[model samples]
Target: MINPNLALKVLDSPFHHTVIHNFLDLDQASLSLEALAEQEFIPTESDLFSYSASNNLSISDNPDIKSLYDSLCSKAWIRKLESLFDVSLSGNVDMAAYVYMNGDFLLPHDDELDSRLLAYSLHLTPNMTLSDGGSFDFFSSNTEGEAKEIVKQVVPKFNSIVIFKVTPESWHQVSEILSDVQRFSLTGWYHG
Candidate 1:
């Protein structure tokens, strides 16, 4: 695993940015879903969009998931976020899986509530095409608080994970899925 300490400089820099790598172990990570029929976790209507005021998925209170969440939190990657954001993360883990079919998309928006301090997403499916429009986009802002430019686009790959500050400035969204294949991922937020 890469030390998240190296990402501190990037996180604290003035420009908005994102980190991408295939290192997270989702098979071992705990999962909870909104749909019971899906077997595997799947995001609800609210979870699929960024504009939703609240998520509809319920996380497992099970110890295994809690242990996995705790282990990941101890990793250098999460520690780097703690240092960069100047916030200590605490409380229960709220997570859900996202499965997008063709034409599915999440509109651009910032995370809400003081409760959600940080956000992370781990991709699980593979063989996705870049042109399929499922990439995550990070935006830059001007002094006046307007979107200045798209600073980066992180392509979704198997085991690829993205961690970012969840303030109003850390604005991001997912493009529409253009392929027939399903796009699967585990998405969640950490509270301070």
Candidate 2:
């Protein structure tokens, strides 16, 4: 379990701040889950659908995957998010593990779930090169148009967890993965 104070610090950091942690054996987990996804799962439009071209694997219904998701949600990290945002989440909050292969990407867009109030993702691949182009880009905008300046660019790394407010203003996307190796991560949203 993560410390609540630490989670608060992560939330209160500057917009789009990137923090790295290496406590979990996410690389091994990623490999195991990736194999499971490849052999036992079927891809759907909801799983792969993004503003840009990308391949995604949804495992919300899998018992093993759901156990992991439940653990994450019960951690102090999630409790801190609730305390910071003053929101209570409920219902069946699902999760998806995305595997971005070479040339796959997700275009800039806000998560559009009415029940969701926060979004979280944990990178599971090891030694991911920043130049591989799977970095997350965050944006800000006004009534005029897309904001000229980029808020931040977060490099995806193993065991790195990113939690953020989810709204129409929180625009973000995963750039195209340029490497042959798959870029894997667990992604989900908190619902109310």
> What TM-score against the true fold does each predicted structure earn?
0.71, 0.73
lDDT of 1 by residue, 152-191 (tens): 7778876567777777677677888887866676678878
Alpha carbon lDDT of each predicted model: 0.61, 0.61
Q: Which stretches of model 1 miss by more than 4 angstroms?
A: 1-9, 12-18, 25-58, 61-70, 73-80
Candidate 1 has what TM-score? 0.71
Query: Cα deviation in Å at residue 47, candidate 2?
Result: 15
Which residue pairs does candidate 2 place in steric collision? Answer: none
lDDT of 2 by residue, 1-192 (tens): 332233334443224323546434554455435544453333333443432222333444555555565566674545655776666766345566677777777777777578887777777777888888788777766665443445677888776777677766677788878888667777778787
Question: For every candidate structure, what is the RMSD over all alpha carbons to the true structure, in angstroms?
Answer: 5.0, 4.5
**C-alpha RMSD (angstroms) for model 1:** 5.0
lDDT of 2: 0.61
